[model samples]
Target: MKLLVFAHRLELGGTQINAIDLAAFLRDRRGVDVTVHATEGPALELLRARGLPFIPAPDVRLHPSPARIRALRDTVCRVRPDIIQAWDWWQGLEAYCGVHLPEGVPLVITDMMMHLTRAMPRGVPTTFGFEGLRRQAEAAGWSRTALLPPPVDTEANAPGASDGAALRRRLNVGGDAVLLVSVSRLSEYMKSESIKRTIEVVRELGDTLPLTYLIVGDGAAMPRIRETAGRANAALGREAISLAGAMTDPRPAYAAADIVLGMGGSSLRGLAFGKPVVVTGEAGFARLFSPETAEGFIETGMFGHGAGGADNAALSGPIRALARSPDLRTALGAFGREFVVANHGIEVVGDTLLRVCRAAVGYRPGRVALTADAARTAYFYLRERRFRVASRDAVERG
Candidate 1:
């Protein structure tokens, strides 16, 4: 079957990266012909470099544009896909606004962020990030939804620091310095305040710790984030913090870290690299992904709720602890790597998505379904509350 995929832009966020991976597996393993379209971004650049069949659409937007919509519709009609899938919110909107499909040409959406269900039109089948989202979507009268985590190639991400020395040297980090790496889109909404606070902790730890904070990836917040890092390093009169920016391949950054920190897909990728990850998100939420905390992390969509909710004081413990103890890091890293492989590797989760797509192909949804309203936004508000409570419970019970 021919499959058409849409994404707004490709900036190496796990969501977009996973979309690329999903398209690849569908073409390679599932024997589906796939074409990916995007508004234009670094992901398209990466795709073109890799010789993938990715097309760039001009000026795609959320607020409605007639020309872009017509272009999208024309593209869809030309491809005449058996199934059309949107990997995120804007693309989901584009799928609806862009064209009305012929009967049986199912439209599939992947609501990876959990804040998108309400924005999706009724009867649209969505694949959610976790069971929490699936349950939430079902309660909203959505008849079709599936659960799947982003996939990681565990073998490709296997543990070892073969490139660590070269990367550290290239970044100007001292040979003896301890490295803390976060490979995430450096922005408030994407990372919460975790990345900013982590840098603060590095400054607070001062010259005593001999630590280097390496931030990888980029976003709208890149200028601000880079400025902060630049000022901190200038004030310190050393390369205590380095912004390597977005990499076409972040595996080198992953390989170079003594400890990895970030939330969502970044955290998962860190785990895949066998690096101990401290999970943090939109609040000042932070926590180590230990065996004790793993269940709650998995249950709540693998993101953390900071104790102080954007407080560096609250965020410093997990990073400091991991930095201080290699043994602790080793154990936690092992657990994370094993957990990712066993539960979320590409072969495992990719197959789940393939099955979901196959099932979506043969089914249709009810027209009398729920409205695409504020349901997801409301759920996000409530979910954060639940996550905050869970983080507190874990600490108290510990």
Candidate 2:
């Protein structure tokens, strides 16, 4: 079957990367012709390198964009796909607006975020990365919902896939020092708080153990991370923590780490690299990945919530225990790598996608329902925009 995939953005985030990787897999391995539709960004290079079919989408400044809808409508007519796979709710709504049932193409929307919004249209096939979210979606009256976690290319991210020694040399980290790394976007929301706390914890730990923390990624929170890292290094009179700017490929950082600190797909990628992972989340949450903690992460998608907000000492204990015991690290790393290969491997997820697509084919919703969804989505977007504007004004006044 021919497939048209809509990626919300061609940026260096988890969802877009997964879309590109899965598209290539379905095309080459599953014998399905797939074309990716997305605006040009860093991840476009990945598509080019993988030799996947692509059509550049118009840059979007607002949701439900007229230009995007027109472009998608034109692309749908040209490609004549059997199914449309949209990466998130916004793209799914755009597809709903652009594609008509007379064409006989069905739509599947995948949302990987921790929370699902009420604004998303109902009666369409949907997938979530977390089981808890999927159950929540079902309780909220969503139909045809499936739990599809992010897939990791185990072969590509496997142990020793990249030059760990070279990365260590570049970071000026000695062989004896325990290296902890986090590969993340470094944004203010859902990321900067834990990262800042990790930097402080690493500095405190450096007083007793030989350790270096390397953070690999850049974004809106870089200035804050830089400032915190600088203070930590100054206090220790040594480079206990270092920041590496974003890289198109982050396998080397994963390979070099004795311990990985991350959440979501990044944590899974670290596990694929045969490293012990300490999952970090918002509100001062941190937990070491082990058999005991595995079930909760599997249900919640590799993140957590802490009762008290943004505590500095949240990560110290777990990280310290891992740093002090090489044997424990090796055992946990082995467990993590095995878990990812069995559960989240790319081929495994590709098969699941094929099943979902087959089930979604040729299914169309009622015209009246579709029209209602469009109206409801428009109202939600308008209210959300107004609230954002008001919040910004309040900040300015303060």
lDDT of each: 0.71, 0.83
Question: After superposing candidate 2, which stretches have Cα over 4 Å from the reference?
Answer: 100-104, 367-398
Measured against the true structure, the TM-scores of the candidates, in listed sequence, are 0.86, 0.93
Question: Where does candidate 1 stray beyond 4 Å?
Answer: 100-104, 160-162, 188-192, 234-237, 307-310, 366-398
Model 2 poorest ten-residue lDDT run: 389-398
Q: Residue 36's C-alpha lDDT in candidate 1?
A: 84
Model 1 pairs in collision: 192-282, 284-306, 284-309, 284-310, 285-305, 285-306, 286-306
Per-residue CA lDDT of candidate 2, range 1-398, in tens? 99999877677777777898889889999999999898898878888999998898888666667788889888998898999998776777778667843344689988776777666766778888888989999998787898788999999999879999899998888878999999887777777777898988988888999989999888788998999999999998998898998879999999999999988889999999999999988788999999999988878888888876545566999898998999999999999999999989999988898899889995667788767766776686667662221110010000
Taking the candidates one at a time, how many backbone clashes does each contain? 7, 0
Pairs that collide in candidate 2 are none
Q: Tell me the lDDT of model 2 at 337.
A: 96
